[model samples]
Target: MTTIGILGAGQLGKMLAEAAAELGFKTHVFAPDADPVAAAAATHFTQADYEDIKALQKFAASVDVITLEFENVPVAPLKKLATPIYPSPAALEISQHRVREKTLANSLGIETAPFAAVRSPEELRRAMETVGVPGILKTCTLGYDGKGQWKVATPADAPPLPPGDYIYEGFVQFDKEISVIVARGTGGEIQCFEPVENMHRNHILHTTTAPANISAEIAAKAIHTATTLANALEVAGLLAVEMFITRDGHVLMNEMAPRPHNSGHWTLDGCNVSQFEQAIRAVTGMKLIAPKRTAEKVVMTNLIGDEVNHLESWKKPGAHIHMYGKKESRPGRKMGHVTILSPRD
Candidate 1:
């Protein structure tokens, strides 16, 4: 059986492992420590620091193909691996830095919020002048789930700038936030899942409803934009594009994640081919499967922090629950998710 190596052993990796097993692929999960969630789902687990080159090489040698669950994996170490990595380190680099990501998006004629690179306090001040108040100051790298982000409502309200590069983006009055997941094969074929409307709580994803209540035209445009980005990056796996739909119906690109996304979790129960399966197929050079929805509608709600304790209460018809094998859950941490499939209301 072909063995697949995954770089991060998070819940996403766990899901990917499950999908791999369903497809008769042996999965080896590598992380700093043995992640029970991934280990339970995968065939093997390697516990070693990412900086340990020898360990990485050994892990790479054991797998037929390699992929990453997260983009923050060190590129230098990945380059040393003998096996090929899907989505490419270049794609990860672009997704790692906001400045590079937005710049590349703009180069592709994809609309993004007004943004300026801020390397120093003076530059931030200048960026404030350019982007204006009611903006967001974010680190160029390693920011997610509302971390490493500061809201700047006014010049005085702006927090003391942290060390390192940042991006100042003018706030956009968006009607709703949606995300499209596009998977590209090595042969340059692309399959885009239906766009999903997402709701956030305290800047963390709360719920995602597939087949977002939007006009067919807007959905088509969103899918096209996501497909264009995936093709431009020449990514082998999945590329998820988060976008903001303005009140006037214009879709503005927000961010891109070059892997299975939280929004696409609905596909697990609602679609014939889930995002995780598609990612594995892409990386392994297997035939790509079209993402066809098997349900009329699907709603996925994240179980964050204490939400996991209430899982037993959610037992109802048509609800599929997935719990990551995490021992402890801190505030703002994702514990699991529940997807409900139902006919259109």
Candidate 2:
């Protein structure tokens, strides 16, 4: 049996391990968390810091191919590994930094919110002039789920500059936020899931409606943007592209995650192939499967914070509930999700 190595033992890792097992592959998880949630599902677990070269080497030697559940994993250590890792370190590096990601998208002629790199107050001021006010100042690296982000409604709102590179991005007057999950094979073939509409509360994803209520033209454009980025980045795994549809119906790229995404959780119940399975298949050099929706419509609602407590209430016909097995529930923390498929009329 081929062993799949997974980095970052979070809920995403747990799902990946479960998916790999379903495909008759064993999974070995490596992470720094002493009691990682993913360890229980994986066949083997290695608790080590991301920067520990010796531990990473040992872990790499044990698995046939390596893949990551999240993009924040340190790229430097993974670069030294002899094992083949999907979505390459170069792609991971670009996804980690906002500046690099945005620059790459713009260079591809993909539309994105106006943005400028900010290193100092002076540069931030210039960025405000270039990107405009009503923008957001976000750390170039390590920012997610609204963390490491500061809203710049005006110049005076700029707080004491933090100690990292930042990118100031102009906000778009978007009508809806949507995301597409594209799986690319080692041979460069791309398969895309239908675009899904996302709703957020406090900058954390709250709900996703699959087969977004949009014209076929708009949906096609969204998928085009996602596949374009995945091909441009040479991504060999799943790439989830979050995009915004402006009031004028134009699609502007928002962000990209080179792994299974929270938005794609709907696939677990609504599609023939889940995003987790796609990630594993892509890294293992398997042919990609077109994500055919098994349901007419699917709505995935996140169980956030204490929301997981009501898991029992969500159990019903056409409803698939998934709990991440997290011990504690904190505000804005993703505990699990419930994917509900709408009955066809």
Predicted model with the maximum TM-score: 2
Task: Kindly list the per-residue Cα lDDT of model 2 for residues 54-127, writing each as its tens digit.
Answer: 99999999999899997898999899999988889999999889999999999999999999998999898899
TM-score of 1: 0.97
How large an RMSD does model 2 have? 1.0
Clash-forming residue pairs, model 1 = none
Clashes of 2: 0
**Alpha-carbon shift of residue 63 in model 1 (angstroms):** 0.9
**Which pairs of residues collide in candidate 2?**
none
Error of 2 at 144 (Å): 1.1
Quote the lDDT for 310 in model 2: 84
> What 10-residue stretch in candidate 2 is worst by lDDT?
155-164
After superposition of all CA atoms, the RMSD between model 1 and the true structure is 1.4
Query: What are the candidates' C-alpha RMSDs?
Result: 1.4, 1.0
Indicate the worst ten consecutive residues by lDDT in candidate 1: 153-162
